[model samples]
Target: MHLDVIIGVSKNNKSGACDVNDIEKLGSDPKVVELFKLKKDEVIFDDDSDIFITSGSTGKPKYAVHTHFSVINGVKGMFYYLEGMPNKENRRIILGLNTAHISGEGSGVLSPLVASMTSVFAPPVYNIKQIVQTIQNERCTDVLFLITYLYDMLNFKDIGEYDVTSLDICLTGGSNIPPKLAKDFEEKFACKILIAYASTEMMVPSISSPWDPLEARCSGVRILPNAEIQLVDDDGKCVPLGSNGEIWCRCCSNFQRYMGNDEQTKAAKSPHGWFKTGDLGVFNAAGVLSIVGRKKDMIDRGGIKIFPADIENVLSQHPSIEQVQVIGVPDERLSEEICICLRTKKNAIIEKDQIVSHLTGKVRLEESVPGYVLIFDSFPKSITGKIDRMSLTKQAIDRIQSKVQ
Candidate 1:
């Protein structure tokens, strides 16, 4: 079960000198020799097996084990939702994601191989200029960009200089995208933007289709075939439609288990094979699933449940705000209070009152408005590049404590 044989070792081999035959001899390669020396045991795997390392954004990263069967099933699901069969005429793709994670490994590497498509690996640094150059040069028909990367690309000063007319579809996920950003990207690029919802445990359960209506395309993803989704409340009871709940998913592409972490795996999976995604989401009347936020990220301010995404979405529209993260901080009176950390546009000046006014006009609930606001040069991110809410919350607490002293 040499998993490398499926996706090929060429990309994984840091040194271009290695071939399939030389995979076992990767230790001898000068480029990876030091890496092998430090983590030799972790690198070795049984033949014909695939190992996926979790991003560890929530806690310590875990090794997820996958077999050839699981990989095939996952790839099959990818093509199932695709408009048509992949062919030489329409198979060229640009992959901008890091191949270390499932999103990149599965969609960027394995899917192309299984579907016999040409996948152009985007530059490692994610330079917007270089990425646009590759897309224009290769005339890629399909491409996948992380939501954050796409945000930066949309804001790139020289974006209009590139000839991206060849792109047919652009896919993004891993976080909630502001509606304004999504709409702007579609209008600016003249290509269909497919917002996907997937996890490492469940390869890819849903992706909005190019043919979907603008509202559906902007609001939520359409659940893919052979995938089942159910929203459950605190007691594990399925929630009513259009109500927020923990997203539980069952699909053919589900991962086998967390390598050597039985307790965590058991806690995440149910007896019926449903994997609790730990994400709060709601299914609209149209059956489109909209991710609200992480259950752990929900702010309980005096028994009122506030989703950071709701605040982040509204604040993201502020012309001066480049990136914003809403978090909950401890308050003796209210148990928790909404705190917003903002990254402003260069040379942009924003006042706390301005943010309050913006939220007051946009957010329907008064409790949802941030009570505390802190400005930062930039938000701290985890290894996967997602906002580190935990770190931001700690920073907010420290700032509040310092003022009291």
Candidate 2:
């Protein structure tokens, strides 16, 4: 077997790279060391080293290559945003995200490594009970969760049985954090929930401070240092403040390019170094940026357009709805129809009329109201723990077809 890289795992299960050139220096058996070590090409570590694979929820997964330069810069960016966070050195953060994923590596490992904090690896399974149990066992002071993971934890019936009070602050991103979920989680866990805006292609750009007001924490995020963000329209021109536009970001931590796909790389990145983040965002009068939805996820019903975030936000407020995802399904008359896929609270009962009635008064546009509602025990999740809208749409369409037969 040939080994290009070696990682040293500590007795405590923490991992770090082994930088030793000669394996025999550690007094290991010479025969065994020679058998394990094969003479390989001396690879140089530079700014274009491959590092991450994107979740690929929108389409095919892409390899996000980062260099030593980008990694260090990302750590610096996280450090800048987390500077004033409470008890930085004392933080024992738990990782709820998958370690191989960018959010997991960045938040669970890189961020803590920069901040001089401890990173606790959660169990392999992404179960809420296991996560809460790890938090209780480790007395974790901080943790990062995807919206789906956080929602599951908050809705867990037995979550109150665990002691999560040791948590000082929690971070979440990848999607708009529902306001109700944020409030309920904070109230129940008694910890400040900090929201961050970032992507695998471009590392941390902005994050809400621990001291931010609830509204600011939920809807707006403070821009971090060493990162530049611009909201641009379809023509790639900067949009006026308060107008929705595609989020374009330039940062030191930005990935070099998508491996093996020059077309995708060119489409997502500009020659000027700005990475088009596909996400739609807006800047308020206060210059605080808030993510609204994904530009590619927009639903066009005939000629009318709808952003799923607007509909999801309204449905998320329903008392019985634990988690909701709005997607566009095919329609013969119209170009597309709105479909609401959701998971209800434990043992909660909901009817189609009940869901429609819940949104009728709140949703302004009649077209925005869901044409179909599909309830499931759980929604499909991407590798990064995000709700997979594409898969959900396919599943909804298949179920509807089956029903027609």
Best by TM-score: 2
Task: State how far residue 149 of model 1 sits from its true place (Å).
Answer: 0.5
Each prediction's whole-model lDDT (CA) = 0.80, 0.82
Candidate 2 achieves a global lDDT of 0.82
Worst 10 residues of 2 by lDDT: 7-16
Q: After superposition, how far is residue 321 of candidate 1 from its true place, in Å?
A: 1.4
Reference-based TM-score of each model: 0.86, 0.88
lDDT of 1 at 178: 80
Error of 2 at 305 (Å): 1.7
lDDT of 1 by residue, 1-405 (tens): 224333244455554344666566775788798776677666433323667877666777778777666667777777665526445446678988888888888887877776667789888765778988999999987888877777777788987888889887788888888877777778888877888888877888888877776567867888878689999999899998878999999987787888778999999999999999999999988898989989988889988888888888888889998888888898898898988888898899999888888888578575445778889976766676666677778888899889889
Which stretches of model 2 miss by more than 4 angstroms? 1-45
Model 2: per-residue Cα lDDT over 104-221, one tens digit each: 8877888888778889999767778888999999999888888777777876889868888898888988888888888888888887888989889888888886777887888888
